[model samples]
Target: MSQAALDSLIRMAPVARKSAAEMVVEKLLELIYSGSVKAGDTLPTEQELSAALQVSRPVIREALRGLQILGVVETRQGGRCSVTDLKPSRLAAPLQFLVGLDHDNVEALYEARLTVEGELLALGAARADEAALEHLEHMVHEGHRLTTDPLAFRVMDLEFHHTLMRLAGNPFLERTAQSLYHIGAEVRRVASETPGVLTNSAREHELILEALKLRDPERARRAMHTHLASILRTTREAMQQSP
Candidate 1:
């Protein structure tokens, strides 16, 4: 702990008779969001937080534990903890859990992705830099080569969409899409095994990539819309026949 760490605790007003553990979590989150505590900065020790926040060590302990689970912070050996990297992808863990818990959510997830990813594709087309375009081109080209290999093609499909989302330059949107991507992996795995699906996906991916390479937002958006529409239709039929 440093003098700056103490100053952060001093700046925040004390909790006013609320649940100590929950309040501690809130205050810590505030500190992180306010930039008082940053990624790679070690949090003040249990004794220090307890003394400064005027909360019991037990309450702080519980709060820290909860934070660890939420990916807000990580606890290391020897009672040390630090703020997490704060990536939106960190949220994938929770989303993965939710996805596994409910079969109905699979369709809802795909529908949500279809709605947002169309715009993301357009945005990516108009905004993706040269390096980003090249990256996407590589994936699309390699994906074509793997059309006959379902397993390899499946991995490339996810990577292609993930790269496409990141190129949209919206970290928040990219992260959300990533969560859906994780869930969709299973859905895609099943779909990829179907006859002619991979070949069609490879064709669709090339169209989507070409639109981006041409820097045509309208083309990119329409291409993605057409691609996802077909996927959704396939998903519906697959679900009906699924046990």
Candidate 2:
């Protein structure tokens, strides 16, 4: 860290709080997100951070540990710390853990999925080119063909949504939807056992792809909404029927 950067961080030193380590973590994140420290850049030593932030070295160490677990930073063999690439998978590690912690909150997870995936769908419809539309069409066709094969169909289902997220060109929302989707994986396995569930999902995927083909954002959003609602319903039914 530069002297100027150290001075800036000192100015925003965290006040006493119940979780001082968390506060320190936030401050350090500010430095990362604010572009003061880029990926692969070495973070200041614990002594430097402690002195600059006016916090104890132990607190700084604790904060660094938190960052490491969250995949934000890595400590190399000699105790030097550097920022990670901030890839979606890496950044989403903590969220994936949090989502798994509350298995009963199925509705909450779907609601969040609707918000994130809906936007991604709309953006994909607006921005996808001919090649993207053609690729999605192929995925939809595969969904129909694989309806009888739950395992293969489930993999295609996930890839279909992942394709849309990539089309939206937003890494953050993509990761969020990915995390939310994983939360329902077990429930989806149960739902897939229900005879009509995969068939309906295949049809809904077709509807969504149709809207995307027309390049209609609002229509695409409505299609996505219907598809998600159907999934939620089947998930609830599967949960009720679970042993």
How does candidate 1 fare on TM-score?
A: 0.73
lDDT of 2 at 118: 91
Checking candidate 1 for backbone clashes, the offending pairs are: none
RMSD of each: 4.2, 3.2
Span of ten consecutive residues with least summed lDDT in model 1: 93-102
Where does model 2 exceed 4 Å of error? 3-17, 33-40, 47-62, 69-71, 85-94, 101-104, 241-243
For model 1, residues 97-184, the per-residue Cα lDDT tens digits are: 4556136675677678777798899899888999877887888888879988999987778788888998888977887777766765
Per-candidate local distance difference test: 0.80, 0.84
Instruction: Tell me the tens digit of each residue's lDDT in model 2 across 76-180.
Output: 879899999888778866466655623378788788889998989999888888887888889999999998999999899889988888888778888777877
Model 2 residue 211 lDDT score: 93
